[model samples]
Target: MKTARRYLASEIYRTTIAVILVLLGLFIFFDMIDALDNLNEKFTFVSLLYVQALQIPNRLYDLLPICVLIGTVIALAGLAQRNELVILRVSGISSKRLLWMLWLITIPFMIFAAFVSEVVTPYTEKKTSEFTISALGKNSTKMDSGYWFREPVDDAHYRVINIRRLNSSTEIDTITIFEYNTQDNQLSSVTNAAKGILQHGELRLDNVTTRTLTSNLAQVLTNEQAPLESISSLKTQKTISFKTSLTSERLVATELQPDKMSTPDLLNYVQYLEENNLQANRHIVALWRKGSYPFTLLVMITLAAPIGFVQSRKGGVGAKIFLGILIGIIFFMANQLALNVGMLNNLPPWLTALLPNIIALILAFGALYLMERRSKPRNFIHAK
Candidate 1:
């Protein structure tokens, strides 16, 4: 049993590594082709290649589950074609025992996936984004617009800030802030700055213009009454400093994305958003998904196990491989669909993330059970 397990592990690992390399090569080639249109005098072909190299970790992390499935199917089907699996089965190795061995062999892969998702991918993704933005000489934009943040001033007031462009974590341009009275939800003031600097938990606004509305003006605006004369006072300052919770690290977290964030960073960001009463559904979903990623590898292997149980006379290895690829695509699509549906309906984060995997596990186990039942009579006859 030990020898068989070792042999199975080695075969799966070898095939998985080969599959991952081929997939990565294909992905990088396509990415290089797509990056051609972005090349310029400053951003040359070499720079483009470097950027793609930085992105390889993230791509590998994304492709690991699919590669595992395909690799396992190919390895197991090849073994079955050579009658190795039949020999092992006839030697008192139950189908359930074989399934358990497959799951056991997947532990190393699960650990690798977890490490890549939690450590390597986040750092590489951030560097890729920063490098691309710097090379292109532009500000980073999120969701086709500027980065928006909400910060609480006190019980009675809160501020909404918009930055049109971010050159770096510490530098921003076209800053806009709107302060509102929490009691009446009335606009109290507006501040606009040409540029801003963040340092040591302090935000310094340069060339600032602030408009403050008087109580009467606020009432008038709330009542839809037009004021003929100037009702709000405007003030200009060369530079103004304020202590803020929006540190450079948090700014970078906001600028990149929730999915690109490490688990700890994503957790902190989600808490910050919830505390400020900001929308954090997407981040919450991403956090749950990240937490469940390791189990996703196990699920992929389970889905591939039954495909290898088919006899060589019934189906060729090519057909089994095609089936494996089809199942992998379906699993990917189902996961994405569940995420969107869960977000749209405001479902629980854990449920949204694990739904597809749970469903796949059930289907996989059922298929395994059927295969075991079908093989039992043959085993009994051989023993007699």
Candidate 2:
């Protein structure tokens, strides 16, 4: 009996994974083609293909939760059609036990999704960004005035850096620095440079200007420009590149924004965000979404069970699954809406991120309970 149960579960799981993969493949193909059309302005055929290929992991990350739902639904529904779940019930598996068993099957996939979110998505995004820039004949991730960031030490001194652009390959340009006295609440010094370059834990500034303020009352001012300075003495590697510096990895120790960060980077960024008093709401919600994503897959599976169990009238499991897709669509819309609202309203990112799952989970579980409960045991277990 145990062996039978195991076999039944394995078969369903395999089929579900297969269906999800096929769907994901189709989605990627279409999406890449659409993206290529947009990149036509900046990329050649080969570069466009390379950039899009590097972006597959990101696409897969976005589609994983829905794939989980669809795949689980189809496989479980097939089992229900074969009366395998009935056999499990007759063998003394309670509905809750079955649900738990389904959840157990879901755990690994959830973990995989999380892994992709943390390790795969961010790497691909960074690579994608790099490839895009290279194809466009530019270097650096630095945006206009490049990257701007502030750091504080002892509330008496802090540094600010302005970058013009970050090249595709970790190059920085148009660097400016300001060191201010927090106690005096005045700008202590200003450094302007033609460019800033970072390499191997060292920063080099070209065409530099240094300004010094001599009094608390702001009476004395001195300014000097040095064409070059190596700022390796600051004890902080991040002050050179904000993208690498303010990355989610440096903000936290764990893979906080799995969907948005590679694991190693996510951990650091999370730590940095907390230290800087920056709002991590959006990132936090993404973390929770990764955790809850698997349950959504199980919900999709549960939805499929009843559809496949019931014989096809005019609209069959296909229609039901279509409905399931609609549900997924609605769920995504709601989730995105909540995220935007949360950001705008300063609401908790975690709550907004989980809203879709919470709503779906409730509906899925309630429907399953009522449907199973309302039906007679024999009818529930066996076909008409």
Candidate 3:
């Protein structure tokens, strides 16, 4: 049993590596072609290639399920075509045994996927985005100057409405706030800060400029094109009390997007949201999806076992491979749809994450069940 397992594992590993190289090469070629349009004097082909290279781990993580589906199927189908499966089955190797063997073989792949998703992909993706932005130079949006939102007050309502970016640790890169007068529903002030930080629900602004506009003042400003007053004062303290309702939750929801967050980051974000009584449905779903992604290798490989039952005399290996590809595509689509549904409907994250794998396993077992049942009367043990 150990020898057989080793042989099958070795074959699957070789096939999977070959498929990954082919798929990775094809994908990077297209990425290179796409990156060409963005190339310039500063963002040369070499820099663009560097950016594309940074994306390799993310691409590999994305391509894992597809490669596993194709590779495992090809390996098993080859065995079937060569009569190895027939001999094994005759020696009392049931579909259940093959299923276990496939799962065992897929364990290392699952570990690799987890590593990519948890560590490598996140860093590389962030680097790719930052590099692209920096490489593009001053063309990027550098915090809106005209940004504002209602700041609720008994007299002057204020709300820290928008954050442009989390430029670095120990500081908020940029922000916009709106202050309103409750008496007449009039705009009192528009404030933009070059940099700020949130500490205990208050936004402390640095290098802020406030513009208080009225009809006459607006006309004066429009006509004069006078230098805008940079609001610098001791009384203002350059501090805006952020609504207690706002938290890091909003930052995570917007700038720190779920797709861009690693598993640990997502986990921490989810806990923060729960503690703050914020709705974390999307983040929760994303976390589970990341957690379950590694196991997709097992599901994809198990799915290939059903195709291995097909003898060369009945169906060409190409058809079996096509079948594997079809199933892989369907499972991938189903997984995506399930994630969306979970987020939209507030369904259990774990259930949504595990649904595709569970369905694939059930179907694989069902197909093998039928195949075995049909072959029972023929007594092919000796015949094959």
The most accurate candidate by lDDT is 1
What clash pairs does model 1 have? none
Candidate 3: tens digits of C-alpha lDDT, residues 1-384: 888889899888998899999999999999888878877798898897798889898889888898988998888888888888888877888878978888888889988888888888878866765565455632214344422222344544534456655543224566666655655655566677777876666667887777765444335556756646543222333555443434443343343447557977787767766754457788877777787787777778877877866677754889888888888889879988988887778788789788888898899878888877877778866476
Model 2: ten consecutive residues of lowest lDDT: 247-256
In candidate 1, what are the lDDT values of residues 323-349, reduced to their tens digit?
999999999999989988998999999
Model 1 bad stretches (over 4 Å): 138-145, 215-218, 222-229, 382-384
Judge candidate 2 at residue 238 and give its lDDT: 25
2 or 3, which is superior by lDDT? 3
| Model 2 quality (TM-score) | 0.75
Candidate 2 C-alpha RMSD relative to the actual structure: 7.1
**Winner by TM-score:** 1
- Candidate 1 accuracy as TM-score: 0.95
Tens-place lDDT digits, model 2, residues 1-384: 467557756876686668667976787688777866655555777776776677677777776666666666666556665666667777787666666666666777777876776677777776666565456644333333445566664557777766655544545566677777876667766666666655544456665656554443233224244324332232223233322243222312221234566544544555556765665565666666666665666665555544444434343556656765776677778878987888789777667777766777777678768766766676656765
Candidate order by TM-score, highest to lowest?
1, 3, 2
Each prediction's TM-score versus the true structure = 0.95, 0.75, 0.76
Write down the lDDT that model 1 would get. 0.88
